[model samples]
Target chain A: MAIRSSLWLEYQIEANWTSPVIFILYNTLKPVGGSLLLLAMYYVVTGGFLGGEGLYFLYIGNAFYMLVAQTLFSVGWIIHDDREHYQTMKYLYISPLSYFTYLMGRSAMRFLLSLLPLSVLIGLGILLKIPYRIEILLLIGTFFLGWIFVISAGLLLSGVNMLTARHGNSIGQAFSGIFYLFSGVVFPIHVLPGWASTAALGLPSTYWFSLVRRSVLGKEVDSIMSGFTTGDVAVRLIIISVLFFVISYLTFRLADYLARKKGIIDMSTTY
Target chain B: MNVMLNLRALKGRAYPRMIGAVREPSWMFWDTFLPILSMAAYIYVYRSLDAPKEFEGFVVLGGVMTTYWMNVLWGMASQLYWEKETANLQLYLAAPMSKMSILAGMALGGMFSTSVRCISIILIGIVIFKVEFVVTSVGLLLGIFGVTLVALYGMGMVFASLFLMWGREAWHLNMIMEEPIYFLSGYSFPVKALGSLSAFATVIPFTLGLDAMRQLTFPSMAAQWGLVSPHLELGILLVMSITLLYVARLSLDRMERMGRSKGTLTMRWQ
Candidate 1:
């Protein structure tokens, strides 16, 4: 019930500002613009429009990575959105509802919001003649796992933001920017420097993208984890995602305790 | 038309942005660090493709201009919307000063911090990527850059008024503009690569500015990669600078009237 209510609330907050047609236009154009940006880069670098396997690798990797970028950013920023913008964080906390569930609900909305753009990118990929051999069960399983991992990380960020000042608002984008570099979103991670590639392995997002590409492309077309089988990648993704979930729960608990003790739960950064 | 009073208004508005740039040391860290990450990623992409060394230089220059583009969007364009949300818009509206002066002040203040970040990114690109440049005319380069800032911030001033006239759509519009502008402006590559689309991109002041800079900085690639002659780009930027500032003034006056009549000058959270 809490999840449903928060989801509705989020929809209203997101949609009420503009007409439906304009809203859809805004949502679609932004992501398509982002993908086209990558396509333009690939076109310039490779001197091929979209026929090469490299373009497909980058196109698909970038598309799926949007899920992480948007969902994680939306969830991570909910603290400031509620406290500073809406000025309702304190009231929600005092209610008899688990804030964790509420956050998950918000994450759910963001995940849904990202889908239109994700689908548009995939369609664009298909039009570009990128061969997609999807294994449905594999794609669904990998997606849910990836979603879990992103939400967990977002919750952790939200907890940290609760403790920090408003100046830390860009932390979400900064983290996403880090992932964009390390996780082989637009390029292969092995192409990264030795130290950077080593750092890439430490992030679950690296494997998540690997598996997602595997499920859609029917093979590890281009990945740092090419040596590892699908089973190995899945296991690694599961373990790290579960690890992130546990750590996030503990961090939120601690942050909640500290925020309450510090009496900054309703702290408004904007005067 | 008291010039002295408006100049003070400009100074008053610019003072906080300039101070805030350095006051929060962490902002500098993220500002430089994130762009460097992006710059490094593009450099690696070019390296992976075995593209020419000049391509990396293009990315470096693009990275530098990207700082200014972002500052224009977030620091100048949407600044009024942020102020409105923070309850500062009412005070500004009530003041007896030119809105153009306030925006001009923001543009100047934003330049101070963006300049710091741009220099940082350029220096890091030199050390980390071993990027090189060939500058035949320092005067021409500075001239293009100056005109570009004028035109870019002039457009930003127009956006400032439009953003305040709307409500929450301003945030969405800003969010939607970022990657699109980067793509359209060819922030990480030569705009000519976009082919005929590059003509449409000229409406954005930085596209030509970046292309002109790349041509000057990498003269060898200029013939092959130059979108158009640098002199032509310079002339366009100069024209754009005058046209956009005039439009900015007209838009600010019109939007201020609309906002006041619509009772949206102080509306929050809508």
Candidate 2:
């Protein structure tokens, strides 16, 4: 347990030091720029500011979506880097420490790191005079649930990448793009086409965004869960998170078994 | 003999990149199809804001132009880092061909691949969103896009040289470029509306090109041309291209000399 925790801390320190300028810039400016871009689009289209409610939706939606996208991509890339770039996957696989525990620790570290940028974005929002109704307890609760749901999906993706070794990066990119499109990150899901909105229904992000927007902006929670209360939404998220965790764990174990059978556990090249 | 060798090197280098990019169907889908999702998101933003229906066309055009920038940043700029990681950098450096020829080949191949994807995206956006373009001058629009590619890829050459010296830090540099450029370049909105930043944005090649193209295609809906005319934008792009290419060559020479002294070219994970 101690070793696992230490490894997680070491990973965080190393990542921070690796091009610290770029790391800081990316975590700060990327989300800021992203939110501004969305707001800019809204401004141009409407010929006016997005008012307080609209600005709040765009602000928290973009910030939270960026966090989810980065966390998910990092989880997949961590596994890909261990196997392909660093060539440390085999040793880690053979180690006594639990891989699941290691992954959870990494996810926890990433979630914590993500908060710095999230706070920066919120500060920008406040400066811009976007209205907010912060329910601290609900915000914290939604964040935890959102992280679990996102991390579980990420683990499943990492496992899928293990099975399809050559396309791991593409797989990650595809998911990020698809999620950004369908998950109501920049706009409400209702604005999407019928088919796309239907697809969004299955994603935990839809519910997560609802909870977040409702908590932060005091917007009404709607969509497939329109009939459900806030508590009902929370319960649904818990159920979805547990379901994703089980499926991801099983998928990861299957991928490990397949990799051993194929004798490609230590393959360094992408293909 | 030297001329023949350079020609052969250019062809040799370019064909492989073109083939490699499409060798896997999945790669093609990710580069081409997946990016449309981003376009879709922007479309939704327009819808949410109740922007003029024509703004959908702006978002689509911006999305299409972004493919070229992606090619420049990832396909060209980061090519050397990828080669170094794969141990091909050493082989290329030892070869007799000029490094410019290799980079040119990569730029050509990247343009070809990304252009195909860009066209697909534009077509999809038109069909799905029913975006109507009022192209007043097709030739002028094409000219803007052509010159923009030249300037953008020339910048890519400079970036490639820098990345050659940067080692693993190149990846972060590439990441840092993505969202900032989209915001600054007015990929989904008019740079004129960016207020004071408009002056800074006009200097960027893609911003100039995109602004000009939008002017020619949707004159009524387009922002004020910071350069006054598309022809001037084309001339600016040409000058920028030549200057950037020269800088790329100079930097390549400097980077090679420094890499040799520091023994960093062959060093991995630095």
Candidate 3:
């Protein structure tokens, strides 16, 4: 526990100390900028009108998407960075601490780190006067549940990263982009094509976003699974999250075994 | 003799960069795939809002043009940082060719590499979404595209100098700028809709170029927006290109001199 907590602290400090200003500005501005851009697109398309409901929807959706994106990216990239850039994979592999614990610790820290931006985004929502009753308990529940799903997804991605070390960052980015498109982050899944909507159903984010929109906006989700009540959706999310978490652990172990057999884990930085 | 040697050096630098980028199948695949996905996302956004059908074409065009912006920011501007990280910057600086020649080579190579992907994106968007392009004159359209490339690349030259001076911070700068540029340049909508923000957006060559291209291709839509004539837009692009290139050259020279004195050029972290 001490080792894991120290590792988390180390990562937190290193990431912030390296470029504090950029870190703050990027986390604060990037999501807000994206939301504003989407809002602008909405305004233009609607001929200069975005209702409070629409604005709030975009705000919560974009903020949550940013959180997911940053977590997935950090998890995948941190694996690549440790194994390749820092050449510490061998040390990590030999360490007393479990790699799974390390990842979970890092992810926990990422969730905490994500709050900075989430707060800023919520503050922006208040400033913009987007009406929403602040349901703290529900918001917290949604955030924790969403983090579990995202971290599981990230772990699965990190397993893929362990297998394909050179292309890890790009693969992570590609996954994030695809999820952003399909997961109803910016638009509802019902609006997507048949194949895409079907594919989205397989991902936990679809359910997660639906619940989040429900909790934050105090409105029922208008997605493909709109018939499901909040409790039903929550039950579905919990099931999927647990299933994926187990699958991700197995994937990581399998990839680790293969990497060791191939003798590629530590030597992957050459390319 | 020196001019001939420099020209030879430029060719040597450019061909390898061009070939190396194209030979990376993953890079090529992702570059083509990501933009189309982004365009699709925006198309969905438009659909959700009940936007006009023509706006799909606008989104597609804007998405395709963004490839150049990516090439400029990542391929050209950040080339120095990559080279620095790899310890090749010192060797390149010590070589016989002028630094500008190397950057020019990178710019040209980047354009070549990105153009292939851009054309793919355009074709995919058009076929998939059925975007109609009513080109008034091919010659005029090409002229606008040509000058826009020059102006955008010229802006890239300035970014390169600024990035080189910033060291590792360039990565953060690149990250910070991505979505904001998309917003400012009206990547998926008309800039006139930006209202007060349009003033800031016009300063970017990308906005001027995209707006002009859209106007030329969709004259009817252009009429509705009261967009500036294509010729005037071209003139503005030309002026911006010349001014940016001139200033970029001077800035690069000054930075190099200051770097030499401060030892910042060789420093790994700044």
Candidate 4:
């Protein structure tokens, strides 16, 4: 079952990349390049103690924050695109395959695919002379948390997409905008005034950035919940992740129930 | 008769779009809300921290003005891109009027419509946040407004043309502008945080427009304007706007020729 689903995910990804949608897909990465160029300019102007190499502390914190930040941006569209292309929601319901398994496989493939630009840009960071010890274990630890946050959010959204379909993409895009604004990606959460900071704190992406900042800049975590050890954050992340994952699964079931109630789950993405 | 005819077309063009604009409340609300939230979020955060009222007021107003400026200018530039790809351009081109009139009509109409959002922000800022209007230097403010508007729309036309010539790479460029321009504008943070190493950060129109608006609101800041305005800031906005307008027209003209030949060209993008 795993092998079959993995292969199916591969086929979907290959198809997405082989056509005009590649431009649309890469449009999702537009910020990564701009972020690179912006950081370069920032270093050039603010160099040393104030701006340059001395400020690498803030840079690492913010950059790592933005990576998960970018992931949370439009990754929900993995299924939205699938639904649009194949009207696959209905097909999923009727098929013998498990819905979560299928979607997870597809997301895993896309998660890898989306990371390509980020990996390249990470190398570009080295080219930019942003130094780091390159702690793989710590990196993967945070990446796992980020991935869990993102995948769960995407699932809930994908479940929403199962209902909204093509229009679901718009809703997903809207969340992406909100994510950029609220997440401490572009600016520090502490910089925000009052209510905005409260609202931002609720987003898991904020916590993901907190973790990423801790991992990358070797910065101390500020939030009590944020300062947990890798195993600690992971455990908490898993508990919260399970809730979201369950919510999404149950939401998809609700979506399926409603679709079955309405007689639309059988329809393909072509509509 | 020719002048009168174009004038009539312009009036007709502007009014219909103005009415059509309000029909899409979701887009309007969001286009306004996204920037407002971004700015408001900061204001709320700062107030929570008990930051000085003056500094908060200044950043909030700067954000409001900068956000509106970006939306208007970007909307103008992206009109064609939006219109063309969705296959809506063809329908507009086929309308019974001059293409230039229609293009001008769309551009003017967009400017007038979105300006309503800007005005609303100003009112909200004054009422809720006590962002003083500082109308003490209306004449200077007017001059600044004129320069800022001209610079914004002109560069917008330039970016709008990118869609015609480049098709989709135009979007790539547009997306790139979103974050970098915000920082360069110095809407949230002090100008010093931009770092002194590069003058390039100071010159973007977004930063210039914010500087002008800031000075206008607090006319006393006119002396300190030198800190923000180093002349190159003025030059870049001026030079870029005119040059971009010219480039945009050239690109459109090339499109015109090709479109005429192909006999399947659509109206210029919105």
Candidate 5:
């Protein structure tokens, strides 16, 4: 883990310039930035600053949605990219350490690296007169757990891709889009009909967004989930993180071994 | 005499790329689901609005229309981009076929796979979501789809041309143009809800496509106002698609002449 972490930190200092990374950042900025612009346009269109009562909620919700969604998705994208490029995976295969340690460190660094896009979103939120501050430890803890869970999920997907080697650049991107719908990222999960709402209910990301909405906007989610206390929420997330690591490691180790047997490890990184 | 032989060789080359693209389940799976899932999200979200609005059925068609064109355009454009970076592109180029024949293979594969998804989504929306469908004329709905297919794929060639020239930078920037516009164009939301001054109508194709779709969804809106003109929108998109495709073709011609693809993995901080 130590060696892997050190290598990844050095590696990320370099990956920070890729166009997709920039693309992700650009996409992050547009929604919040565009919303603030829409606020201006709303004034132009409706002839008022605070056009309607719910628009503020929409702004705050969308902004919070943007932060959690982007961070989680970026984590997935980074880890997926690692598997695709096989840059990390190369070292990961030959590392003098447990694969879990290697996977965790890579995921951790990528998870932290994903925070780059949020800077602009945070700036846009503050600029727009919406409340978008990080509330210290709890906010940090929420982000940490959320990012950890997301990265672990990414690691698990990485393991699958390790075997199949049938990687799609957009899997991370697509998974995020799919999850965004559920995790109250783009639209509130509350608004989703029974099947999708129930489908989203099973994901840890939904809970992550719940905590974000609570910490940021303090909106009541009574309409969404019932009888889940704050303490239960924390417990559930920790369990999710653990579940991800334990299960993913097994799949990853098996895939690693199989890929080696088949000599797929030496394959070109292009696809 | 040589031209006849070249045509046969072209057939030999282009046929595989088409069949192979379809045979790959991954391509078809995404084509099937991505559009439906995207449309389903809108259908899911709009339930919160006040029930008096008759926007649901109209909006669903627009959402489906947006998905259809997006798949055709984005799919076809990206196929070229994918072929470029990956080693397979060289393989395709090295084949004995003419470039246009090869491109036709790509366009056909993409369109066939995506249309399956589009039609399936419309069915799911109607069946699962209970989205209302009153077919005054299946002919009109089919007409919109026809125009959308030609315009979208033609414009896709236009987008693909830029990729052939400038590479990833143009490709990334161009992709952003597809989805964000859907929202602005009033695919999911009502044009009435778009505020009186939001001249999205003046600028975008969805405005016209959505109007044609709305004719099927809410004929009264079309019958009464005529302010929401379907023919005008379709005509504009048709012209725009041709113009975009023409520009794209020119760009591709230049790119093929240049023949420079730097496949370097630039180190960038994430």
Candidate 6:
């Protein structure tokens, strides 16, 4: 019930200000713009659109990344949005609802909202006749795992935001930017240097994106994770996701305690 | 007395932004670090395609100019809306001196902070990426850079007034300005890559400014990438700067009148 209520509230906050048509258009424009930027880069370098393989690889990777980026930012920014912008964090804390669940509700809504862009991208891929050898089962599994990884990271960010006085919003951008680089979102992980690639291996996002690309592109495209079997990826994703969940849960608990003790949880530093 | 008040208001509003970088290590760190990550990602993309070494320089220069574009859009353009939401707009309007001074102060401070980020990116590109630049004429480079900033910030001032009038729509508008502008402005690639599309793109000061800088810096690569000659682009930027600033003053006067009559100037949480 709390989650449902929170979802409705979040929807109102995000969409109520604009006409439904305009809101959808705004959502559509941002992701489409982002993809076009990548496409422009690809075209400039290749000198033409001679090869669809590289384009498809980048397109699929970038589309799925929106889920991680949006969920991470939405959940992370909620702390600042409520405390600083809306001034409702204290009221929310005193409510009967579980704050963690409220955040998860928000995270889930963002992931759902992100699906619009994902669909638009996939639809474009089909329209352009980019071959997609999709395995429905693997695609679903990859999405579930990606959501777990994003939420955990977002939870960790929320915990950190609880302690900051100003610019808690930037925390989301910092995390998303790091993931864009390390997660092989727009390129292969092997493209990174030895140490950086090694660091990428530690992140669940690496395996998550690899599986997402594989689920759509199949094993035809070569990648660092091309050698791993579907089962191997599933096992690694589960392990890393669980590790992140435990860490983020514990961090949020500690942050919650510290924030209450310090009396700064509802502090606003807009200046 | 009025001139002194405007000058004092400008300094007063500018103080925090200039000092914020020094006072907050984390903000400075993220501002410098996050842009580099994206720049590095693009650098790798160009490398993977086996593009020439000069392409790395193109991406680096794009990253530098991007800092200014972001500051103009987020800092100057959307700032009035932010101030309104925070209940600070009423105070600003209620205070003596012109509101344009507040925006001028914001532009000045944002330029300083953005310059720090730009210089850092350039140095990192040189030391780490080993990107090289050719400067045939320092005067030409400086001329374009100055005019581009003036034009860009002048547009930002106009947007600030419009944003105050638009309220909630301003946030969405700002988001639209970001990645789309990056593509249209050829932030990570040559504007000429867009072909006939480059003509429409020239309305954005960054588009011509970035192309002009690239031609000056990478003369050999410029033939393939240059949309227009450097002098023509600079001439366009000069005209744009003058026109935009004049339009900005007119818009501010209109916005103040509309806000006063509509009773929306002090409105919050709309």
Pick the DockQ winner.
Answer: 6
Q: lDDT for every model?
A: 0.82, 0.76, 0.75, 0.56, 0.56, 0.83
Better of 2 and 6 by TM-score: 6
Task: Considering the true interface contacts (CA pairs under 8 Å between chains A and B), give the fraction that model 6 also has.
Answer: 0.50
Supply DockQ values for each candidate: 0.49, 0.49, 0.40, 0.12, 0.20, 0.57
* Top-lDDT candidate index: 6
TM-score for the A chain of candidate 3: 0.90
List clashing residue pairs in candidate 2: none
- lDDT (tens digit, per residue) of candidate 6 on B136-192: 889999999999999999999999999989967887688778777888888888989
Q: What is the C-alpha RMSD of each candidate to the true structure, in Å?
A: 2.2, 2.8, 3.2, 6.7, 5.4, 1.8
Q: Model 2, range B134-233, lDDT digits (tens) per residue?
A: 9989998888888888888989999998998886667766765777788999898877778888778766689989888888877876544333577887
Scored against the native two-chain complex, candidate 5 gets a DockQ of 0.20
Clashing pairs in 3: none
Interface RMSD of 1: 2.6
Q: Residue A57: error of model 6 in Å?
A: 1.4
Give the Å error, residue A78, model 4: 8.1
When sorted by lDDT, best at the front, the candidate numbers are: 6, 1, 2, 3, 4, 5
Structure candidate 1, residue pairs in collision = none
The superposed Cα distance between candidate 5 and the true structure at residue B217, in angstroms, equals 3.5
Worst-scoring 10-residue span by lDDT in model 2 chain A: A164-173
Q: Where does candidate 1 stray beyond 4 Å?
A: A163-171, A252-271
- The TM-score measured for candidate 4 stands at 0.68
Full candidate order by TM-score, most accurate first = 6, 1, 2, 3, 5, 4
Give one digit per residue, the lDDT tens place, for model 5 in A1-271: 4756744753454344356657565555435443443343233234455434334444544555444443443444443344443346566557777655654565555455446545565565554565544456667788778766676666666665555433233444444556556665545666776787788767777777666656665443436643566667677768866786678667777877787788776454332
Better of 2 and 3 by DockQ: 2
